[model samples]
Target: MALLDLDPRAVATARRLAERAAAPVIDLARRHTTVSLERATLRLAGITGADHTHRAGDVPWVNRVVDTVRAHCGLDHGAALPVFHALAEHGLGTLTDLAEATAAGQVQYRVPTGADAARAEGSARAAIARGLRAVDRNRADRDRLVADLGDPPRRPWLYLIVATGDIDEDVVQAANAARAGADVIAVIRSTGQSLLDYVPEGATHHGFAGTYATEENFRIMRAAMDEVSREVGRYIRVTNYASGLCMSEIAVLAGLRRLDMMLNDSMYGILFRDINPVRTFVDQRFSRQIHARAGIIINTGEDNYLTTDDAVDAAHTVTVSQLLNERFAHEAGLGDHLLGLGHAFEIDPALPDSFRLELAHALLARELFPDAPLKWMPPTKHMTGDVFNGYLLNGFFNLAGALTGQSILLVGMMTEAVATPFLSDRDLALRNVRHVLDAAGGLAEDFRPAPGGLIVKRAHQVLGEAVDLLARIADDGLLNAIAEGTFGLMKRPADQGRGADGVIAKAEGYRNPATDLLDTGGDQ
Candidate 1:
């Protein structure tokens, strides 16, 4: 139920403008393939482990295979055909064998110029089918387990983060949080891991702020969470960053591990990580396709905008980004249920009508994307070190969530911005959310904003401003607007950024088995 009567025409206009703005970028994405995409292909082909040639750090086998393919055949034909052809021609028994040969500098991938494309594609499809089957098994297991057990009995599922920089410690904290009433446990990725071009192999024990997002780490966490789920008589969901340079690769891993949700956003890497806009666009498309095929809910990063830009002045930008994210998600075949569109409660508490404004914003998003599982972020931008005030602010944040019917609420800790939250801190934060949820859980069902009141007025004003911003973005191409710092007040030119070199325009016969698999509804 919409507390504020938002204008349908204005919403449609904003959507139209966003669609127009995303058109060219989407076209670019369709026409290009990135290194991450190729590497994801190798991973899907069953290449595990890493090159141990270096004493310090091991390079992933996917990297070695794709790097070899790039040097020999170029990525125009993609990594699938070349690797498949090499495997068939040399009679390599498995992908790992091929990787070993490639690492030994004894293999040269043949460019599929006049080769039997059908045979190569069939072989590639078979390999990818194996991986796709694994993903389907994970999904099936999750559904069956949830059916056998149950889900959290709440509207806004409590989301808590674990960032102990160690996988084992994260598991302990995650279990504790689950027992403490956190419905979802997000294992935050290590800082700067987003910038890495390749995912680290195997379970890691050391990190600066958070654990490395490796396939092994995901596997370990999944096991731990499964045990916790059984212990609690409810399924425990896990999440990690499927953003940054290896967006699609991480998506592949998440699918393999049956991660419940992923931090997948179109503009986040461009705005925050300085990743090339075109590169991020291409990667996000493939990543979302994987998420769609894996039945994974994708949580966008619209909340990050509030951290960098003024929450009041930049309110419309959040809506604008949400509209675009919704469109992109749809284009990638994600249903509304899988689109965990994000927003936040980051408005300054000093404002006189802050609660009303927060209500308006949250309600606006809830009304706009009624079916979407909106991931409402907690206050972080204005989180002072004062524990008492921070606790009060988190209470207000939780109140907004309960009042506006947020789907996924990331519990705000009083220690936010001051330190990595201790387990005790998370317990207190969860208690705050529990208090608000228990007290006002049913408020959204019964409450309605006063007609022409502050909330209604603010909602209309934000919608109007969003329409204006969308129009401006449509007039200037999305890429140009991004280069002009339209989103997070950070300009990332279309040409320059990390991973620019990875973007390759598709050749005539470019093939990605994953896309074809997704299109065929391969074992979802």
Candidate 2:
């Protein structure tokens, strides 16, 4: 299925280097925990609702429980060990009860004895197992729906974005897009939501540019998608961003609500959002474990690199990131099929032979990760106010996507830079993608670059550069490379960034049963 003749040795070398670069980071992730991660563990223990009576604000019960544990006993032994101990020793019935009593100043945490520790650990494992069973039920429901209703019968499933700053409004728009031939509907998160340290509660109506990614909103939108799926005869998949400070929290929520995909990448958070590398690494491992158990695909953010750096000049960086993403995701138990590795068509249109260069890059990614469901993004950095030119650029993008056999194609709106896309703009963009895909869908079957042709040569050159870059990164260490402004032109030190204070080193006797359960897809 490959178009270009690539060197297997070089590809192996790149993979080896990527794994070498990721080994140290993976070790760090294994030996550390985060506040959000512990909070997510509490959430999996069946804690819900918020403490509106608190003087500070409407704090989630998970937050209150974790905060109490952190302030009182510290988080070295993991939040679950102490919180569950408090419950068992005090004869509390549920984590919710413990959280309530903690908020009311009724529960006092303490280290437990032999019998008390055994009882607490056993009860905590049972509760976490129950929560994981809920996720198992959700996954079963999704599988049943897809089996009975079926999914889109095409490559490059049309992906559309809906961001109305309101959950109800987003539901209506998402259903309409489904009816209009969108295979996947991604509800864009509200602006700046990623930077918030905690996940919000309930369905929000007032956001700046996009809807909040709360569990309530996820439930509401997924319900609507199911209804529309029955009407359209194709199962509609829902997506949301699972990056930033509350990455693990959102991943757990997505599992409970049965989201189909999540925008998740630790490097994306560290480089673009200024999140601490250590914190991002720890959170992403726990988040991806949740995703792996929930049967959700993860879309990395390598495409965003092109938005900040020149696509032509930084092409090799995209490849290097993809390799590293593959290694990190694999280390976290994500198979190739679950990795929606990202790339984009953002080269300036005025550049000579830009379209050919775009094809070369796209083909290279497709060949590199053949089993991955590549999420091919369209041009945004080069989009101007000229709608016609933008539409034409999208046409070429669609053609490239179809030619390269992209698995998920995010539809590009012609009015991208001019304004937020109206429904009419989405319809027009869908029409453009449909025309190209229908007309030239099988072009790749007959498309063959000449021996040593420009396209083939460019691909080889980029692959060589990527291998070289991966070697340097492996030698320098991924964290040090990031601090040196290696990816996306951002310099984020491992020790200094947002949420660095949230990272906590694990105690010598630290243990988390959730990870043990999820390590084998929750069979335990």
Instruction: Assess each prediction's global lDDT (C-alpha) against the native.
Output: 0.90, 0.90
Kindly list the per-residue Cα lDDT of model 1 for residues 1-524, writing each as its tens digit: 66688888988888898899899889999999999988887787788899888676798888989999999989987889889888888888999999999988989887665656668888899989899888888888888998998989877889999998899999999999999898889999999999999999998999888899999999999999999999998999999999999998999999988899999999999999999999999999999988987889999999999999999999999999999999999999899999899999999999989998999999999998999999999999898899999999999999889888889999899988697545788888999999889998578788889999999999999999999988888888999999999898999999999999999999888887877887678644
Per-model TM-score on C-alpha atoms: 0.98, 0.98
Full-model lDDT, candidate 2: 0.90
How do the residues 1-524 of candidate 2 rate in per-residue lDDT, one tens digit apiece?
77789999999999999999999999999899999999888788788888888788888888888888888888878888788888876788877788899989988776455777677777778888988988888989999999999989888899999999999999989999999999999999999998998888888999878999899999999999999999999899999999999999999999999999999986999998999999999999999989888889999999988888889888999999999989988888889999999999998989999999999999999999999999999999989979999999999999999888899999999998987656899999999999999999689898887779888999999999999999999998999999988888999999999999999999886767787788766653
Clashing residue pairs in all predictions, respectively, total 0, 0
